[model samples]
Target: MIETIVFDVGETITRDDRYWASWADWLGAPRHSLSALVGAVVARGQDNAEALRLLRPGIDIDAEYQAREAAGRGEALDEADLYADVRPALTALRELGVRVIIAGNQTSRAGELLRDLDLPADLVVTSGEWHVAKPQPQFFERVREVARAAPSATVYVGDHPANDIFPAKAAGLRTAHIRRGPWGHLWADDPEVAAAADWRIDSLFQLASIAKG
Candidate 1:
């Protein structure tokens, strides 16, 4: 049985419109322009960070993120940023006696912001705090450690195929491919990646019905 259900934050549990809007400010591009660029990057199966760098050379992602946080504007996900189904789905999973964790690649202060929001996540960890990012085996191992559950008995849910599903599966965690967001939607039709997921969900609302501890 899966005793823990860990979710990817941005675009998985968090809708992330605010973050992109910030990116728009940094690029001095309209929000729609940034969104379109992001879509292009996703459609090409490219890394989001790398694509941003390619678009704006010498862009310091971390520095900008810190500056924004210092100004109390860095957290991309606000109360309004969460998907409508996130809280309900998370609460339902918690009621099943499963440990629910929200872990993702985010600024160092992301956990602090999320805590204030008080989402149902039992634990929230960020790559900034953990000193590692996803698609790296160590990242998932840290999550495994924090979860206090065997990797095989844990479920890793996320919208990214290369980052979340593949790496989590490699780490012996069952993977759920959520078919939303750029990464998820762009790759949803890919035969190989789609075939690999232990679970495929259209929405977090379906999580309670499918992921049983």
Candidate 2:
């Protein structure tokens, strides 16, 4: 039986529209242009941040992040950013006695914001806190360490196939490919993604049944 359900932050639990919009504003680029660039890079299998680099050649992303924070316009999150199904789905899963966790590649500040939202989760963590991001074996290792459960009993759900499905599956955890974000919709129909994911869900609401089964 699945004893734990771990979630990816962006697109899984929250919409990333605000995230990219903020970045576009920071870079003084049109929001639509940056959004299009993100999709383009993702389609080419390049990092989405590459869009920023494309906009400003040789840009130091970390330094820019710090500058944005100092300017009081850095990463921001709130209840409004959450998906409609997030609360109901996570609550339903937890009510079923399944441990729910939110883990993803996000900044430490994003982690703080997520906690502030007071979502119904056992723990909220990020790659920034662990100093390790997904698609890395160590990241999943850390996840297993925190979960304190057998890999087989844990489920990692996310919208990214490369970062979430493939790596988590390789780490011995069951993987669920959630079709909700840019990456989610783009790769939802890929054969490799379908093969890697133990479950393909259109909404978080489906997790309760998966946890029960």
Candidate 1: where is the Cα deviation over 4 Å? 70-73
Query: 139-176, model 1: which lDDT tens digit per residue?
Result: 98898998888888788999998889889988989888
**C-alpha RMSD values across all candidates:** 1.8, 0.7
lDDT of each: 0.84, 0.93
For 114-160, candidate 2 gives per-residue lDDT tens digits of: 99999999999999999999889999999998876799999999999
Number of the top candidate by TM-score?
2
Model 1 TM-score is 0.92
Residue 30's lDDT within candidate 1 is 81
Q: In terms of lDDT, which candidate is strongest?
A: 2
